[model samples]
Target: MATKVTEMNEVKSSGIPGLDTLLSGGFSQGRVILVLGEPGTGKTIFISQFLYGGTTQGNENSMFIGMNEPKSRFMIEMSGVGMDFDALERNGKFSYVDATEVRRIPEQAKVGRIHVGGRELGLVNLIDMMQEGMAKVTPKRIAVDSISDLVFRFPTIEERRPVILDIIESLQTTGATCLLTSEVLSTGEERTVQPEEYLAEGVILLRRLPRKGMRSVQVLKMRGQKVDTTPRPYTITDKGIEVYASEEIY
Candidate 1:
């Protein structure tokens, strides 16, 4: 008799109630997901809760790569949402990497000069830092606060593509599921080229729709997974992001 090889989908719970169902039971393991949204759309809060949830429930370590926010400010903001980032760090279950140092490198490469920004601190260096951090903490979940800042820092898309690819490859090697956030820039007509969306295994969009006087969230896409296509409502509470069921909202 021949033995059948069973394929399994690695899944990580989002920690938000009703979210897993929307994500086909959760995000697939070792896959990169791009979270797109505008400002005040609760993108950071959502990703933070994801890491905290994994740490608390699954005992999984997590690493957060911040491009804009400093460590102190990041912690303070998270604290206001009832997430004890300090405690998680103290427990060795969470880690943070500040990419601001790399950002400080001047952009010497002019348009068409090379491709991307001056290759001072390329993706290789960033990957090195990420690997070093992972070696020490061995996190199962990772989050890159925003890739848009990194992209803008670059001089051209050609240069940015390879660096982004390198980062994605590095994350896959770490065997950690990663959530990469990006800011959406519309061209007033239609959304322009979003390379990250194409590069990632899954993409989730958080958009603010102007309602009677308030805004609501809508999940745009989750590739290769069955998700709640209906735009569910959500709120930023003292305990982070809370997604309401479609039926419950109406």
Candidate 2:
């Protein structure tokens, strides 16, 4: 049998211990990670923990780009998880950008026009905003809360794919490890794959499964890393998503 070869790059801790072990030490640096899940499945908590951990433990600068939520609301949500976003920002280790003002580019030809909600803000403007944010924060780690929101704003999937790819490419240039959250469709219906998944270097899937009248959180996958393949139980506490080691089936 061929054995897995472990790379020597420093492991970036996920802030969640059990999860770190599954990631074969930690996530590879400067790679994009996609976090997909259903509502209330703790996707935001997972990303918050990741950014908080990087700032507190890893001592890495981080940035959060909000799509659907306002920056204030995002911080408040993080506060619920025991992550002091204000303190982190005060400490000069974290920052956020609210990009909910995206619009459509009406001047370009129909083939080139960027359409979102009947208003397109051409790819140039989108990239410009991202670049401007990076210049201000210069983060070592980044997260985009829910890429699905952006996709929905874009009238067609074709218009959205390139933008998503552009965002990923731009982040890679900054040499920051990135975590992007995406929403999955309702369970029981076959889910359509998002093109962003193919662009990302790693993927962590979170889901809520109905079992015996209770709901459970599970990790579906973590690519390029050795992770618990079993359905480990988890809970969203005041400190965020906590996975029980004893419940891990791997």
Candidate 3:
């Protein structure tokens, strides 16, 4: 983590207490935040908490666009951790768009069936499908469970950059604070930076130290909010990722 400062007036609680403190009181309003980490570093759990907190505590509607997993399986797993998406969706406060499934079963994942603008959308153009879903939900908060798949989807930066920018731009238009997730491996003092880190307004990097058997969270960059660069230790329990903002870990 590096120290870089900025100022902001209004913020949204991230639902993780220590993290909110590191973020100077949570994500800036409508800011695009990237949660970067390797597999099992709790990226999905972190975003799940953000959306769950928004619907349950903030009373705001939110959307989860999942690329790497099935919606049914994802929800059931999250339910084990205490986030009841089915209950929230039943009340019309939460909506989900399975990004990968649309690519797999375009006929089965019908736009009208999902109520995404009540029209047809082709798999080749995912942004259109995302747009229709956003417009239909008009959520106050939006999350893409792990757009890290895009890093592989496009393969090369040239092929990936446009698509990445396009999705971020589209999300910006929805006027919802967005949380994006990606996968990255961390070494001793250096880590690989994904393309999404460059495009996002803020980047929250999570890492697991194998020798210590502990996970840590850091604010790599926050465009409009003051950032506390200290590496904060965090853990994934039954509730979700609980960040200890000011604590140090071995």
Candidate that scores best on TM-score: 1
- Clash pairs, candidate 1, are 117-155
Residue range 71-155, candidate 1, lDDT tens digits = 9999999999988989989988899887655555565544454555455454545677788779878998999887776676666
Candidate 2, superposed: residue stretches over 4 Å from native: 1-8, 103-123, 154-159, 212-223, 245-250
User: How do the candidates rank by TM-score, highest first?
Assistant: 1, 3, 2
The positional error of residue 77 in candidate 2, measured at the CA in angstroms, is 1.4
Q: What does each candidate score in C-alpha RMSD?
A: 4.1, 4.6, 6.2
lDDT of 3 by residue, 94-194 (tens): 88887875444323344454633211232245666577667766788888877655455555777667767877887887778889887774545755666
Kindly report which residue pairs in candidate 2 clash with one another: 103-119, 103-120, 103-121, 104-119, 104-120, 104-121, 105-120
Local accuracy by lDDT, each model: 0.75, 0.72, 0.76
> In candidate 1, which residue ranges exceed 4 Å CA deviation?
1-8, 109-122, 187-189, 212-219, 247-250
lDDT of 2 by residue, 10-38 (tens): 56888775677557667777778888888
Error of 1 at 63 (Å): 0.5
| 2 or 3, greater by lDDT | 3
